[model samples]
Target: MQEKNFITVDGKRFHYMWLRDNCLCPECRDPNSFQKIYDISEAQSPPKPVSVVEEDDKLTITWQEQPIHQSVFPISWLMAHVNELDTPVQSSRKIILWNKTDLQKERTVRHDFHNCDFDVWVNQLFSLGFTILENIKSTQELESFICSMGPIYETYYGRFIAFIIAMRYTLFFPSSLFPLPSSLFPAPKSLLRSPCSEVPKNQRFVPHGYKTCYIPVKPIKGTEAVDLAYSAVGHPLSPHTDFTYLNLGRLLQFIYCEENNASGGESIVVDGYRVARDFRQNHP
Candidate 1:
């Protein structure tokens, strides 16, 4: 046994103890057992104190026992299990900004039945509040690029998705610097007339000829899935129940990508059921 250094999540320093005598994995405990408790004691032989290192939102503990021992856990875990520790401390940067409006928008957009590419649509709204890019070039090059898109990533409707012109630029830029030009993406006069000017001009852009549709889990390699495109940004998307409006039921996520001269934007998706299952379990 060795003296161990424990750093409370709130930055306080002290010794630590776990109120458990034996480490029990699920296999070691009865599956139906309601709960288990263990006793704690001071180390039999006090050696050098352990060191705690904080890195990238995680805390690592290292101690010099007869055999060196180390473990790492998220800083949030200490805050969550504060009561189990002898002393509780608060973290300096535990505060998170929950954009309620953004959450509401997420719920609404995911459920919207309209035929608009979800990523393009969300990016447009985020950019200008709302936009309508019109008179797009619909160039042969753009068409060729769309053709190059393989069926691996196509939407449920099997249409390739992208902006009208060939050039790739920022859609989320300030209105003052509209990325895509109207010469290539001209807005419809009717749609422009009704648009909320509150939206930044730069935010609006027309989608290529591709129509919006549901994004399936199946990889349409070389094809782009719009919804999966933006959701890949690593945000916590809420759990959605069945859809009442359309028999389409519920979707897991969406995916999309832009080709030609771009790198490092590969798609990633996590299983919702696995996330839910892990959230409900406590381990040894």
Candidate 2:
């Protein structure tokens, strides 16, 4: 049977342990296996008061570390180390806060953005996380954008609500741990070729002559989707990420069809990376 104990520090029972040995710091854990030690030390204690809350079977801990450190821990992990603790241990959680002023400025930019100012919008995307290019001349322009760089590839995961090829351009972006967040939109269906009998009747679409196309990362098991082209009529596309494979430094590329008979659907891009970085710079 599993046993549990409370850790007392500074005359307060924290119901947990604190030791360099018991610390779950990433450096102390095995990268391959992701397991750590449970040793608690006597010299360890937080300089400031830390708060703990117990709800049902889960434990929520709050510390001086603001946004990042505040998290819920499983009661089981707490019980495993509480028995041998003597003092408060340093938590690796770093608190982060969103900058309200910058956020407001960004909102103003979004509200003030005009379709005529494509260059300004592009620069904004470079400063932000992603960019949108409206008034695309034709499907050829969309194709050209996706095919601008070498060694690019499109993917088909069959998960799209409306069947369209999703191009996955992995080459563009820096390999930074801290980078700008970004996202993109699919092209129009007029650019792809038909997906013959190899695709299901309901799932089949005309492929848009995209070479080196592959499958997108699985949003669901046993399913596949790719970037072809999106329809222009009332395609209310919200902001979205492509895959978890992406790192921090990434640029979002979006092209919207601006032809006649187009109902409604303005392109919208965001700069989540800039938002985070600005927040960190201003707050930190």
Candidate 3:
């Protein structure tokens, strides 16, 4: 790697562009929101720092072109953002793709939620696509915990219903793993089905308060679901993701299972990405 026109924080080296773009000064970024106001595209050429100085836990930079433009960044911030670099980056987290063989051979032991690190727990979820956690006391506790990470979004399903959350697990597989905390959601009043619950015919399942799109349960005479879209006898929809119809490329479905009651409608898992790759390479 080129050493010139670069700043090294702790042991990691960052390029001139990285320094210019991450200027923490009020002129470049909003002090309250911390959102960047400085446009990196404003620089036609690579940014050249006239002087780079490290004092206390902060690194300050002065650019020759702007003269007034100075960037002060905490060393701690630099370390945390080491991933945003021009060179090859290494992360402790890894993504491992699995097939049915691993599903049968491997098992996940539930982690104690009260004593677990959220950062490490999330890393594990991404690493293997799913993890089961235990000891989350109640719906209020779970909602509070989830809200800490980000805001809660209510769509076709309202805020944290037991039924919709449960159905999301069985229908969406081979994506991000959302293992239900051992003590999850309120005891479900309805089934874990879209339309998973008792609803009027043709009005698919929408949570109690949500007014959303509905899928016609009854098939059109000429149009039939070929690749396994339904559970009606004889259709036998194949193992596929339900989100495809919604045009979703990737989504994380978190289902907190209090318990499984209904029998026979088991979730069938399929490695869609692997299947697509195999089909392309072998067939073509």
Ranking by lDDT: 3, 2, 1
Q: Against the hidden reference, what TM-scores do the models get?
A: 0.21, 0.33, 0.40
- Shift of residue 3 alpha carbon in model 1, Å: 12
Q: How far is candidate 1 from the true structure (C-alpha RMSD, Å)?
A: 20.2
Q: How would you encode candidate 3's per-residue C-alpha lDDT over 125-212 as one tens digit per residue?
A: 7666667678766545656676676555444435554322123122211111122211113333334345544444443333332233
Q: What local lDDT score does residue 15 receive in model 1, on the 0 to 100 scale?
A: 43
Ranking of all predicted structures according to TM-score, beginning with the best and ending with the worst: 3, 2, 1
- Residue 258, model 2: Cα distance from true site in angstroms: 6.5
Which residue segments of model 2 deviate by more than 4 Å? 1-125, 153-241, 247-252, 255-268, 277-284
**Model 1 C-alpha lDDT per residue in residues 157-272, reported as the tens digit of each score:** 23323321111331221000011111112222222233322323223333323332222233212222233222222222232321222333222222222222323333222334
Highest TM-score: which candidate? 3
* Stronger candidate by TM-score (1 vs 2): 2
Least well predicted 10-residue stretch by lDDT in candidate 2: 169-178
Error of 1 at 207 (Å): 62
Better of 1 and 3 by TM-score: 3
For each candidate, the alpha-carbon lDDT, in order, equals 0.33, 0.36, 0.53
